[model samples]
Target: MENSQNQKQYWKENIRLLFILLSIWFLVSFGAGILWVEELNAIRLGGFKLGFWFAQQGSIYVFVILIFIYVKLMNKLDKKYGYDD
Candidate 1:
């Protein structure tokens, strides 16, 4: 019974982490790239319009970074839950 509860808590935390990371990815990719593109376009980065850069490349870069972050976070979470090898 205690083990069952622990598993539930661990699963809950894992889901929570997933939600947070995915939310950030969505906001960066969809919000900045599409919804706020015009506002972002006013700024420049590396000679390219910030909005255009986000639409074309920034989101991908952010996603990749988020992947690494998720992996690191999950590793910690696993260790905490005694799931790590």
Candidate 2:
């Protein structure tokens, strides 16, 4: 039925968006927060240290902002892809 096809398209779009969002999340959190922490630590943002901020707070804020950005972008993408309901 048309409904089932629409549901499948929705799921596909969601999966694609999820992967992209999670990849960015991992890169910012793990890569910037842990792996490259030392190099980043040398850099400073105002009074707070870069590495510490990324690990403790910055990554989380980035993730939240990214979620909103993803939603906005995905909505536009879905419309362009003809996947919007």
Candidate 3:
């Protein structure tokens, strides 16, 4: 019974992290890149437009950062739950 509870808790943590990461990804890729694009374009990033940068490169960068973040977070969570090797 305790083992089952532990498993459930671990799964819950995983799902929660997944949700949080995906939300950020969506916000960056869709929200900044498309939804607020016109407003963002008004600002310049170096020589590039903010909206164009986000749509072309920023989202990809954010996704890479999110991957690292997920790995780091899951490692911490694993250690906390005695799941780490």
Write candidate 3's Cα lDDT for 1-85 as tens digits: 9988888999899999999999999999999999999999999999999998999999999999999999999999998888988
Query: 1-85, model 1: which lDDT tens digit per residue?
Result: 9889989999999999999999999988899999999999999997999999999999999999999999999999999989899
lDDT leaderboard ranking: 3, 1, 2
- Angstrom error of the Cα, residue 81, model 1: value is 0.6
Quote model 3's TM-score. Answer: 0.90
Alpha-carbon RMSD to native, per candidate: 1.0, 3.1, 1.1
lDDT of 2 by residue, 43-75 (tens): 999987798889999999999999899889889
Pairs of residues at least 3 apart in sequence or in different chains that clash in candidate 3: none
TM-score of each: 0.93, 0.69, 0.90
Model 2 scores a C-alpha lDDT of 0.87
